[model samples]
Target: MQLKKALKSLVPPSLQARIRTWKAERAIAVFEAEWRESRRNAARIQVRRPIERILLVPPDPGTLMGALGDDAMVTSVVEMARARNPEVEIEVLTGRPVASEMAVAHGLKPVEIWESPHFVRDLDALLTKRRYDAVVALGADIMDAYHDFLGSAKMIAVVDLPARRGIPSSVLGFSFNARPNPRLAAHFAGVSPDVRFRLRDEISFERFGRFSPATSELVADSAFVLTPGAVADDLGAWIDAMHADGRKVIGINVHPMLFRDATDEQIATIVQRGADALLACAETARVAWLLLPHDYRGRLGDAVCLEPIRDRVAGILGDTVRHLDGRHRASTLKAVAGRLDGVVSGRMHLAIATLGMGVPALCATYQDKFEGLYRHFGLPDWLLLSPESFLVEGTFRDALARFIQQLPELTRIVGARREAVLALSRQNFTIFDDVAQTARIGSAGQGGSPAPVQDA
Candidate 1:
């Protein structure tokens, strides 16, 4: 069964799509069709055409929700790389078990995983034995730790989100009265020339560009390119029932951690506001609401907030207001979200994933990362923001009121802009492919000396 599924990936993408539709209709009993859906979405865009060998280095993984998010990000990157060069041989030097677990959840198989407690030794051993065409550093600090082992591989550094202390002191250069960190300068300086660096957004690009020695470009977060797979029939039945009653479904996801700093009154106010917002929307707009939990793990996960909100809203809407069980994976949440009319989430990744699926989602963002993404989607006002504001009396109520007003238009806008948003995401890897191929050509074109991992 696994081999048959694996062989399916080798078929042409158009045929694969048709095959999936045919299989889905026939109820062919495929165990993990969503994984195949993700790959099909991936095949729609590529940066190069045929990368022979590529190595991806991921950061230390987190628990369920975070891990799934990271997997989505990495998978998007890998698919983008594959788009650049079709039939590329890829390996994720998978370090943490969390990441590998996510790989299983996503049904991305034939993964070449290299795991070890001794990361440095394992990394060096792998690189020393295999000559990869390119090495994509998924995290910023990977170079600092593994500088010595890269050898001649084309190194592509991706500048990830929520950048810390941008415009590294090294780029300003030594002034008569000012000096930069030698270590920072040396690390970036040692990058193999022709190395391509990608910043997740324009804001990060502007912040990181001056310090980077390699050509840097702006690209959408890879998560925006991933597509969700199918959900269980039981869940589907719930969605069908909701729609059958002629009530549009609006999904709500509030991160429990959002209430950590709030007072008892403030927390209650926020929850009440969410419940009230649902009631108001349902009454005015003729809709039902579901509590969507994007993050499924940890002390203050989505389930924690979702259960309370469900209880609070249950009296108002009864069975019309149900919350999802916390057991579903992130992909499962996304699959269910596809049935929603629109979504309001505090979890940014959920918004991105849902929006990528062309679901109009409102975000309750708390960082700069959120702004760049919403801006890319062409719906800047779709987010309700600030942790501080949630503490202020009536702030959430006011915000929710505004969001309710925008929901209808927001949905239409997302439906219209979905293709453009995806096009921007694909641009990231197109630039990435150009960078990787340049590094590859440079290495071969010049018989380049081994890139020195030394002090600047």
Candidate 2:
């Protein structure tokens, strides 16, 4: 629209009116030709690189940052896949209109965004649009469209989370029922012969393996592969100030789910409880707290969902607690998180962003995803499962007390574990490399390190 508008404004009004009429007629003709034959004989441009053009499909769609840490984690799949072959052209295929701000932060710039997501919508159109040697799904769970897209791409569906018993009734096969549904079972069988699995956690591996007990390699969340970038100016200034005071900064991520799902009164209770714990810990220990809201949603389109809670914490803690919400990219958030002394959050990916960088974190919940990841990080004791009720149980203060007192050990453990996980995460790329090298989907003989398309 900007390009068209600018071009039009440069022409005289009288000439432009006539030009528009003719341009529309010509555009229709071009559109018809493009529809009929644009991609028909389009030569499959191949190269010697392990992979060529890659399509990344996220499980659900929203502005990437709305999913917060999830955006960084999913995009890490693109980063991981690209690591196998840096020159590979990458595109994000999702329902939301992708903005490049998130991708740019990771030193990766997507070539294009295929509309919508796979499954019921754009899967077929996108597959037919380009010959993708590889298609990777970022979300943990296995969806119904898993096999279809996997078979269409002639590769694997990377399962992140497993279909636990009775929890998710939505995914086709794994219902609360005694037996797996036959139709979904048939769909499950559609996985291509050449496919591979990079299951994020053991539970996902175990549950998915029940169907195809073949070789599903267990792995940690892809977020571990993301390296932090330089912190932004404003956040950097705050960190520097705290550093001048000789105070260690701890990131406090309050997930929107904490309040969005609760009533006003419940929200106040949660805020008071969380703020109380943070203030006690901060004032007593002489540490600064950075309020990081991983998810920004609800009223304003770009607003972080935890504004109310952030406001509450800020009101009490004053300048000691500052909120990081607006326009901060995932990479920026991760960079900020990497600087934190510790973290307490309800979100998984935020914890991943922090913990993956060797920062000690006490998650608000001990869920399956965290458990699966901590096993790989070798810091299983670092998390507290579902700590929402911890305040009421009078366990919040004591638990945090323990986390604070043992900060040195926690830091050492996380730093070593992050190094180990990063090493292991690199191996996750081998599956894509093997599949692409053997499949050899693109045109041949073009080598010598194809221009670095990893990022702009």
Candidate 3:
């Protein structure tokens, strides 16, 4: 590990990114070829009616703890499924033995993605034995090969195999970058028509339409349905105290990914300037700041990245600046976010949570996903900040001050579109229902036997 870190330190950030992209593209190409060949020989499947069993594949590998955004997606789907059918057996595919707290709380069974040495044979055996009524893949930005190419390929295979068998299958609401990986796009273009695809934003919908127009539909992200849970007593008390003191409370989420390309000195400089800016904004605006951490993936977590800035700001401002220093669930954090007047978040889900509560958010944009999210609130180009621009001195403070100034209007806009956004988010599950019903009709027409469908 030390040697690997040393080697990584020697390479420039731009070149490292290029190398990673090349590797992902090559692996995707190889996987696509093998997958196409397998589909050519695969037999069709027949699904039974009154959908009782569901197989949900999340974007993350192990427990749903790596990223809150991924966890919110899984949680929303499970909750919505149960609300529709209390007895629906929902099993989540995980790479680890243990499931997340949210999964256990929701009574979701965790099934290992790889249970044997033979990937294809094992999945086939499991599916045939379990006899699932439907298969849903949470394609949250991974289908584009920009995040995890291997995870994207695995999700596609899981959905494709079951889909070829005539079972209800869909890739749940997901996003595509401005320029998606060509190999991945081509692969989706040729996927079986029986598989349903839902895009979360206009940008992704417009881009995906060029390839799979017939299969893709525009829908809002499922995270919009996540309900707020209770906040920690201490955090709640702090917010109440701030309000009692006639101070406007603002929340901020900082992550290391925003500074992934910076040197150590550059990171320190950026953090120092960011703290100075926050202090300045607080002094002028009479705002008390809440340092919120959304992701908890070891070194990459927002908590690890925000500690230094938190210390610096708190040392000077005392109780006016506080850091939420513990492991908290996504819903709990959402509840805390709801108490804030506005939020500036490096993580998209944190922004989603705040906005869902009718609070204004300035998203620190990455991977081009935030544009569509902002569009959902009817305020495109109003509250967005690029990492490149944020790294410069004064940019962070300038953006924060401006965001604070526009909070009232932004909150009004978010409130006006809140119901519409929730309605669109509900459409994700409705699409699954529509496909399942259509599959049922098709099954009944053929005497409840597997329909003979051509392989892609």
Candidate 4:
């Protein structure tokens, strides 16, 4: 009998399912083992460069949650670099407005800064400029698709390498997410000649071999800021439920500029509806207003706190949304998220931060990011309100009630997920030592000499 038939004949359906799952898991384990060994062999082959003058690039650093992980990656890189070699100069290629804001806040005084008028054109020029010793592609961007085209950099570090994308041998790959996407890593390893794909525990500069501490605190504190909000469809109903429950309602507006991209009517409609809702909800309790710090170009009514959100939003958007910048925002939204018995937010990062800090937040999402994070942590019961359905007041109230009821479970789940993420981060540390040693050897090989082994 054929192997497939023989296996099927020997096992019941349920037993077969378990066996198949086990076999798949075993294959992955073996693949990773072989891949790591191959990397070890490559590390021994001889590296020719000790990287310096690194550039950090990510997609859309100015948008709210779009830039959170990217900023963390950059911060980690800076910290790692400074620790490894304090004098190693660094530069950033980012959106102009966001770069300007980040410049003063973190020690991000880049030796060179490239502000892209168009992402593609500016990115090409920035990557083509004088040869750098290394380039660190921090986040998921189309530009990272062309890392090999960045001919000047001797060493390249990527956050994640998709399955079989054919990256060059010279680049070192690192998974940026808290956990490894083992299948993706394996596929990449199979394609690239000298790639070493490893599970990185902490998203850090030192962990990735840059070894700087210049921006560590920003990263460490990033996860604590998410405040959950309502789904787009159930906003009205959620308000009613809050009132019935005698809860104070905070209305947070965290989208792109309100009126600029919209026709006057569209802008007016949103404002009018928002104002009306605030008025209607005001009867139940007070309204605390929070706007995505950079989203307001024109000041709303007196209740809105535009300055702080604008300032921080300016840092992220750089100059693309320049007219929106003012006194930098520090997110008093945090104070709100901290004290609130519950939260409803459109901003996904805010939810992550808030939940991590033991706040119960309901997400009103229009995209995959919110749902992705929610599902990643197995909290499907929380609302994933769509734009159309979010207007319904009854739906909102029901969802809020359900969310409130599940508070205890939500806390446990968030706590468990946070632990898993931290544990994965801790596991990534070993990769750091491997890469650092590889660099030391690469440096010696470039000079055509065997490195002297120093007994530690």
List CA RMSD, all candidates. 16.4, 13.0, 5.9, 17.3
**Tens digit per residue, CA lDDT, model 4, 338-365:** 4445555555545654555556667666
Give the poorly placed runs of model 3, Cα more than 4 Å off: 1-50, 98-106, 114-117, 147-150, 380-382, 435-456
lDDT per residue as tens, model 3, 1-456: 999999999999999999998876665555555565556666665554455788888877476546788878888887888776778898877676655444566688777753323445556667767878788888888887776656665676777777777677788888877766554544564556667677788778877776443366678888888988898788899899999998889998877677655566656765776688888898778789988989887767776557888888887789998888888878888899999999889898898888888888988887677998898888858478887665687888888898888887888999999899888788778634543434322110121222222222
Q: Which regions in candidate 1 have their CA more than 4 angstroms from the true location? A: 1-49, 61-66, 77-89, 96-122, 140-186, 210-213, 259-269, 431-436, 439-456
lDDT of each: 0.53, 0.53, 0.75, 0.38
Candidate 1 lands at a TM-score of 0.67
Candidate 1, number of clashes: 11
Writing each residue's lDDT as its tens digit, candidate 1 over 90-155 gives 665443576567655644322333332233333434544554555555542223223322211112
lDDT of 2 by residue, 5-103 (tens): 998789999998998777655543443233223223223323234766655545443344456556676666666666767777766543344545554
Better of 2 and 4 by TM-score: 2
Candidate that would win on TM-score: 3
Judged by TM-score relative to the true structure, which candidate is superior, 3 or 4?
Answer: 3
Q: For model 2, how many clashes?
A: 11
User: Which has the higher lDDT value, candidate number 1 or candidate number 3?
Assistant: 3
| Ten contiguous residues with the weakest lDDT in model 2 | 161-170
- Model 1 poorest 10 in a row by lDDT: 168-177
